[model samples]
Target: MDFWNRNRAKLAEKRRLRAARLQKKSNPSSAAEYQEKCKEASRTYNAKRLLAFKKREKRAEAAEVKHGRKEANRRQDQRETARDYKVEYELMKSGAEDAFRERVMHAMWNPAPGEYRIQFSDGSYKYFD
Candidate 1:
């Protein structure tokens, strides 16, 4: 068993050395080829980055759209609230003014023109007459 393990380790080391030698036997490339490979890698990296950026931008746009809709709805609700308040204010003002006018009319019931008098229903003349 010890010998088998030693042989296995040696075989693995030899295989690794042979693979390294094969890599060392590769053909050399020109500067132009190296630059072209660099450019290709850069292009691939930039394409991936651009795709991620576009996805992020799309998500941001969708969020903005949702926020815009929410804001629009909120503004609409505010407007409706303001309109209702205005209507209620107008109604209250009109009712108060009507009551004031009625009171004024009741207090100024002189039978003759330009005479601030008070003639009772019993035909009695008061001090205001």
Candidate 2:
């Protein structure tokens, strides 16, 4: 397989292995049990997201009332800026770029970028971003 397919396969295998390891501790006897666990996870994740959004809205409104909507928005924007900065930190790592790279495209104009390896005389290769 080519690099992109190989990389995707590696990632998929890693996910499967991790899932197997995790599931061993909480083995559900049936598919229905697994489905229930998945639904509960989805529900919990959504509830947390909703709570966060509500908190941000309240903070924004409070800021608007005390100061001005512009300042409130600016503050909220700063928080988002910080969050994005943390998310982008992965880009600094050579291996982490693959996680952020857009892999799913309806129009396959080109294959995704691959980390090309430079091989030395002794058959050892150096990985580069």
Stretches of candidate 1 exceeding 4 Å from the true structure: 1-41, 96-129
For residues 1-129, write the lDDT of model 2, one tens digit per residue: 999999999999999988876786567565567678889999999999999999999999897787886788899998985574455444424345455343211111123375444333334443434
Which stretch of 10 consecutive residues in model 2 shows the poorest summed lDDT?
103-112
Residue ranges of candidate 2 with Cα displaced over 4 Å: 1-29, 68-129
**Model 2 alpha-carbon miss at residue 18, Å:** 12
Model 1 Cα lDDT, one tens digit per residue, 20-98: 6566556345445666888999999999999999999999999999999999999999898667445434533465656
lDDT of 1 at 82: 62
Candidate 1 C-alpha RMSD relative to the actual structure: 18.2
Question: Best candidate per lDDT, number?
Answer: 1
Tell me each candidate's TM-score: 0.42, 0.33
lDDT of prediction 2: 0.62
